[model samples]
Target: MRHHSTQIPESSKLSWMLLPTKKNTDTVQSTTDVLIKAGYIHQSQSGIYTLMPLAQRVVTKITQIITEEMERVGGQRMSMPSLLGPEAWKKTGRLESTGSELFTLTDRKGAQHILAPTHEEEVTSIVKSMVRSYRQYPLRLFQVTRKFRDETRPRAGLLRAREFIMKDMYSFDIDQQSAISTFHAVEQAYRACFDRLGVPYVVAEADSGNIGGELSKEFHFVSAAGEDTVLTCKCGYAANEERARGRGASGADMYEVEGSEQRVVVPAMRRPNLLKIKQAWPDCGELTLEHRKSGEEVASLGQMIALDEVCADGDYLVDAAVDGLAVEGIDNFSNVEVGDWHTAQSGDACCKCSTGTLESQTAIEVGHIFYLGDKYSKALDLLVQHDGKRQPVQMGCYGIGVSRVLQAAAECSSSSRGLRWPVSIAPYLATLVPLENNMEHATSVFATLSNICVNGARVFANNVIVDDRSYLSPGFKLHDAQLLGIPITVVLGQKFKQSGHVEVQLRVPRLEIATCVAGVDVTGDGYEYKAFVHVDQLAEFLVCALEGQF
Candidate 1:
């Protein structure tokens, strides 16, 4: 097999390469600063950015990885229009549900159009026109395109940008069971994609907001700067804090309290409405009630009974959080205490296991997968004939924030030096730098490396560059290389001058080297270098080293 060259030219000659210096700000450091300094992207507006050459290459590489994984899961790539009619959204009732986050506009003819934040309705409509029978079930269609949302405050660079790239896939099936199988398949594909990109992520049970689904999962990259709160238990149970739930101890104990004899009888339930209780006893001062076992003040007198003991005639309803509390019984209650009514919190006992305790962490949501059932299919009248009966198509939606992944990669990989991109998604694999006025030697070395084919293909033609800028000093060139976060840097000046050898440095930090290079030193924190290789063996050495063979 012949390998095609993917070599990029020197930065000095490329007019479009705009590597700007870092801007001064008092806030904490951000990946955007590294990106700006490395010439990857530039801010065009408050929440928009122009992907420069370097950024474009990185994004392209990430997209390629995603495309491969998506294809492996039988996803058929197609294009969807960014602008959609209001009727589709209105039919799904998302036009109002989406609130101000949706960007709406009117055309010259006074027809309302929305810059689609998602394509569920449109995709369902398109599939509806094509498939009318259950035989067309299990259809997986995907597209990579721009999505627009009118965010109230689009901050965090690409993470919360107003316009961003997204890969959305919709799966249509004959029933709920088939949709579930497709859902898991898509989930595994997502895992493969993120794994290939070297992103550290966690899959958490998430709330199905706006997308209206019975089950949803989110792939979140754990970072301190993340916007979502995640709760995890050692029992392997994890969930987004918004939808997280926990089991409570059985409410079986009760005690008598001395208060106004006027027993305010309310409904009985697992989690009683505390607000309604407060309204019923507004004049009642702090009613301090103690826990039945711990003797801690977990509830008040006016609060509903915490124990599961049913009131003979009347009892106050209280949440399970105050269960087993010593409280006076009230008369005349009807609601039964059934359901896990306690809100999950950090350090709470894990409901899934007997020993694990839940812990909380912040994470960024880069992708989401939802089992949408037949919500949209029913709303839009998307039905297919199954066994001579028409039924709504069971559907699922999966989305990856393509641009957010780029930023997330930077956030996860960057250090004090700069953006340390993983080799899989780096703009370029290696940077060829010459120390002194050594363009002649540098060019010769670059040309040889570019022509040396690996596996019957040019090794690094478009993927290698020579820092041929004569005006810039060696120190600046090296600094720029580090800032750009190229994984490998090869120098052909001093070492080659003294001996017929080229110096190669693996720029990945010691901790990260293990992720990119297999048998490298993982004990320290900084860049590592291999002994100089003879000039003639430089290309082969680099190819093998990058492939982690050496």
Candidate 2:
């Protein structure tokens, strides 16, 4: 029952009636259009936007959810400077690795600064100075603030914005095992936050890109407009294509090839590296090889056999690690079986289980968690004493794109009718509209509903809106409410004046309305209803409906 005052006050010089007067564009027709038309956000540039009153309300609710989850996991909230010096990035070598992606500028004194896309370097530096002993082994710090990224192509409104809000957290542990435990704790917290948001998301193994780490996982919201390709197997194996791997054949599938010896060269020898080889040699055919002996080099196969004796007593080159091949006496060596070594395709065999097959889908990356190990700590010399010896601290980082969640939620819940937000995150739980002839009755109804309480919390006052603009028709107001995605709409129309029954439109589907109000005629779609209730009964019904009591 935490109470937060509404941003917009009654006497304030702001009103939803002025939304129609704002500038809008019809060129882009998506949920972003509905947001703009509804006056939630205004685009300042290609990827930058100004959050209007309505949009701010939604963002606030989202921030609150993240904050609650973070606090539950003992994450101490703090704020770091957005403008960072080049010293820390240089020490970590990210200044060169990040290249153009790191926005850089020269200060008046000729010192370089970067608009931090992330706070890894800064957080490590801060913890380095503060933590010196193993007593502070598992330290977790988090911040919910704006971040700047130099996106090559910024599009889809807030989904790929240049300036956005993010919840970034850093964890420090005394050892790798403790760091892994901390990582799982943060992962659970993220799951709770996403569940409260009510968005369909998947956690998949991911490549630790510029943010160097040993293991990485991304939380992706499944949507058609997503940018990342996620591969999932029925056997419960999931990973981003960048880090996906296929199941290699076991000893039972090994066979001998009777032909001239051909050399196969794969640049990298890591799990993800095989996928890269496949991309470079798409035309190369697959080769089934026996498992290699201990300490055997994949590159030594070319030296072991001659051209005539192809059937050698050695492992086959299903995948190999060689730079290039040149036969000693032959003019050309073209009989090699060079297949894809790097990428796992959509139909690749599931590495985890035999019965499952791999499938791919596009998804929006809403959050990422990385087991950083000692990459940053060692680079920055963030040592903590343990057992009378100083060692680099194990670290982990977790991030959630706060602004991207807003766009993703809209994409997930949008429909031909309008945008419908979840009750927990909607800007307003409901909109109260008074028909032109029923203004007096609507005023009394608004007061009664606003004073309603659910679990010691006021249900409406700041959470409900009264569309009392007399100049607009009831139909237009209703349309506007639907467009804005308000969960419920209480209309004091002809039905209320004639039969003392109000029409409550439930924009969200699968909600229990009948259980809240007895004998209420709910529509087949579970979206519209006619409820006959006295003033006191009306308050009770709204409390139950908004609180999801059914």
Highest lDDT scorer: 2
RMSD of each: 7.5, 7.8
Which candidate gets the maximum TM-score versus the true structure?
A: 2
Model 1 TM-score relative to the real fold: 0.80
Which parts of model 1 have CA positions greater than 4 angstroms off?
Answer: 1-16, 21-28, 246-333, 447-461, 509-531, 537-550
lDDT per residue as tens, model 2, 341-417: 34566876787788888899899999999999999999999998887888999999999998889888888877767
- Candidates' lDDT values, in order? 0.71, 0.72
TM-score of every candidate relative to the true structure: 0.80, 0.81
lDDT of 2 at 158: 93
lDDT of 2 at 81: 93
Across 1-550, the per-residue lDDT of candidate 1 in tens digits comes to 2212333353422222455543434443777866766777788998898888888888898899889999998999999999999897888899998989998899999998999889999999998888866776789999999999888898888999999999999999988888899999999999888877776788898878789788889999888879998889977898887666554333333323346322221123223323333433455433323234322332322344323223222333333223444334333222223333224567766767888888998889999999999999999999978878788999999999999999988887787777787777888777788875565576667777667666766636577766655556777777887778877777776768887677676665332333333322223345555446677776656566556311
TM-score of 2: 0.81
